[model samples]
Target: MWKIICLLSAVNTAFAGVEKNFVNFGGFVCPREEKALGRCLRDALNTYIPQLATGVAEYGVPPCEPLLIPALSVHQTAGPFAVTSSYTDVTVQGPSTMRVKDVTVDSEQQEIVSKLYIPELKMKGNYKLSGQLLMLPIEGEGHFSGKYGDIDAVVTITLGRAARPSGPDALTCEALDVKFHIGHAALQLDNLFGGDGELGNAMNKFLNENWQKLSDELQAPLEEALREFLKPLADHAFGMLRADDVLGGP
Candidate 1:
């Protein structure tokens, strides 16, 4: 019975891998003066003093900055195979605009000029995110403004796929192991908002209350965008695989 139980456990384990990751990146960069300056960026960042406070009754404009923290590069890795990939020739096409209220503000865009590579197939690649901050205010009741800005990333994913069958001389796998790539993609966040004022204190309270709104604002679009991009790519990639040889079991 024990041997049978062990065998059943192994068979019940799911077989699939679908995930990604980002490698080392700068958490902050000072606003750029000229687009021509390729390697120029600000160094000083106050991670400790800052705190993020969002939506609540104690509300007004939350004090924040309109700037971007630049990420030097974007990379992904698979945990099982330690397959690493970096994108290149990244572009955030000129004079882009993310409209907020009546104000149409202009911002800078950047790209990864050359492809960065890592040979080791560590379970995952590390990433430092360039954060964008915009404080919201009550221009009026129903009409408020989003002090909004975003950083663009131009990257290409470099990973591999293989197909397998359940039989003698069958291929080993149709996908990478989940433990290797998807599960290992890591995420981190840092935001600060404080001023020695009543409004600032309110801002802190609001953030503590409605943090989900802010997180969703940042994450939802990204999730949707990724799904849009990946769906077709996945269809194209897996569509090429031979659909015969494996018996079905649900």
Candidate 2:
């Protein structure tokens, strides 16, 4: 997740019309005196934000799998059950609108900070679980879907010169590091472990009751998953332009 944010920021200056304004990284000489560079970055984001929010970015298993329940112990009126399950073939539906509140640069630190609002994120996948429900054998395979609401995150990105010098103008930047913190995130599970819908609904109720704890447990894995999911897309898009050409600089 951090790397994704860093990579995204590193290419901001590569957006068309902003390359000439050599970012004031440490002590780089910027020829352009105007604020077009800032505008360029914002414009680039505007174009992508809408695309990501409304676009259907497809992903496959091995990379994106259904949410797995590490462990679940529930006491129901019918009975108690402890279970573990795995989901595969995941699909993520991005928000309808991804709003970027602001993008600020700390030249000295080479960091770009941004505030973003995601209206919603929807996901669906298939799952298989083997466990005991009401002390009875519960093994099944079915479909599950979930939606995250009003997510807000703060992303910080640090960029630096590419490790190897290649461009004729020696204008290339790479993502050095990135930090992403989610401020407010709410998730709702429509159906999970829905072998027949009843079990799934019951599980959803259990999850809602222990949402915070579950979130904490899944945070690390979720971050790793997000990073893997976005890396290829970032690389493909960033490869399309060179900083010098985009900036119209020597």
On lDDT, the candidate that comes out on top is 2
Which runs in model 2 stand beyond 4 Å of their true positions? 1-40, 52-86, 128-141, 163-200, 217-250
| Model 2 lDDT at residue 40 | 49
Model 2: per-residue Cα lDDT over 1-250, one tens digit each: 9999998887884764464544432223233433444444544555554544334253221322322233232222323545555656656555325566665645455445556666655566565556654464455666656655566655554444332365543333344222344433444344444445786566556655655544433233334434443343334333443434333436
Whole-model lDDT per candidate: 0.24, 0.47
lDDT string for model 1 (1-250, tens) is 9999988777665321110111111333322222211222111111211221121112222322121222223222222111122212211211112111111101221111211111111111122222222334411011111211232322222223334564322212222211111111112112222223455445445544554344433232233333332233223322332222111111
Q: For each candidate, how many residue pairs have backbone atoms clashing (under 3 Å)?
A: 18, 2
Q: lDDT score of model 1?
A: 0.24
* TM-score of candidate 2 on Cα atoms, chains taken together: 0.51
* Candidate 1 minimal-lDDT segment of 10 residues: 16-25
